[model samples]
Target: MNISWQGVFPALTTKFTAEGTLDHAAFKHNLQAQLEAGVDGIILGGSLGEASTLTVVEKEELVERAVNLLEGKVPVVLNIAEGSTREAVRIAEHAAELGASGLMLLPPMRYKADDRETAEYFKTIARSTELPIMIYNNPIDYKIEVTLDMFEELLQFENIQAVKESTRDVSNVTRLRNRFGDRIKILCGVDTLAVEELVMGADGWVAGLVCAFPRETVAIYRLVKAGRLDEARTLFRWFLPLLELDLHPKLVQYIKLAEVHTGLGTEHVRAPRLPLVGAERERVEQIITDALAVRPQLPDYLAL
Candidate 1:
């Protein structure tokens, strides 16, 4: 595919069977749904996919499957940034080998590095491959923050490319635009902040919970891109609560439950991460059901 990637790139769930093994068929089925929902691309193994917990091999399979299934339809952006630069490069190389259109990486977590150190980390990883790279700024969960100045410095790398802004500060997107203009592609990583981000000039959104309701997510983005904020805001109202779940610590579990409730994918998470429990599970179920009750179902091809 020779497409310039854009629009709602919904991070998909890696559906597993009851036996707990990766269900390739279920995953492909979900991919077809996102394609039908009008997304410009699919981001496999993102935060919402519990990607941090997945083994390198498992993530490889997920990206390979997505590329094989949707290669000609949409660009598949892969997120497989491990804690170290070496591991992150290995994953990025592996994904590029499997034909991923772009690489989405996170800051090296664990150690709090200064601006120069952080820039070195990103620059090293980008130098590892030729694929266009997009940085993921998700300070809330990763315990790491990328300052606007740090980002400005990182942009010096030609391959540093785009950014998935999840900082929750909408002005950051505008600030990025003011500094980089069209040089950098700004994607709204925080779903609730999507409308404002786009209104401020973001190119797209990498919605994690949107896997369960991609049609609504893409519809809002398309409307916004068309300068129809009046309609976009109305559609966003329907997705705000669902968007908040991505902010939850148990975002993966909540998103998986929402997918299951809507018959989009299975909710079987890996071990060490217990399946929901007590009031947590009950509360999640109620929220999932309530969200789905009002959501307009995505069309057949978008519904796996």
Candidate 2:
């Protein structure tokens, strides 16, 4: 289950019913859309998927269901966002048992463990399962920076294969590459930074906004990797407004609203997370409307 990790892999949002149950139909629809759009892989139960609130059974079922639907089309990777080292290991083990191809692991959830402790937490989980692990380095939102030094230590473990470089400082991508070279694959985790990171040599994207605009997302990645910078930037300029939604505090709601406009997703979210309203809702709708109105046509070279 070695993932090539070289293209757009949406950090998919978990769909839920109005009453907060898993919406299987919508979930499958979204998954199918990403696969059809030529995403390199699928990552489930990430922050955008509301990982903190989903129970163990729900997470397990997510992996099981995605694995079934993917049917070997692409790799199915699970995100482990637990607080306790023990819990993270348990979840990683469960993901491996459920047939996940890889794991996107965050540091101990909520608690900002020091470097040594953070390394140990990740190391413990890495040992618990045979699945390849992508260390999620999102210091901006997660408050834990998996420093180059920390990664230097963690990479000793063979399965510690990749990094989701979301420090919000694109320089870190270059830093990781300078240090690790190709020993570790670097996946750009920030939606807005996708083009810059890819241009600067990110191996792939763990895209958030891709859940809504899958074709454009994949297009940007493909264009960049194919050395078509001019074409990539053209689409990126058009994509930036929607990409900004993935950076907002309410990104999940914002992206889902974009999805609604594109007919790819719904506005429904789980409890404690409600739909947008009033001026806020109007503002988001305006952005989506303007983008869809002039959505750039894919270059003839891109058959997607």
lDDT of candidate model 2 versus the reference: 0.89
Off by over 4 Å in 2: 300-304
Look at candidate 1 and tell me the lDDT of residue 219.
80
Clash count, candidate 1: 0
> How many steric clashes between backbone atoms does each model show?
0, 0
- lDDT, candidate 1, at 151: 79
Give the alpha carbon lDDT tens digit for every residue of 113-209 in model 2.
9999999999999889899999999888988889999889999999999999999888888898999999999999998889889988899999999
Q: How do all models score by TM-score?
A: 0.92, 0.98
Query: Candidate 1: which stretches are off by over 4 Å?
Result: 1-5, 296-304
Provide the lowest-lDDT 10-residue window in model 1: 295-304
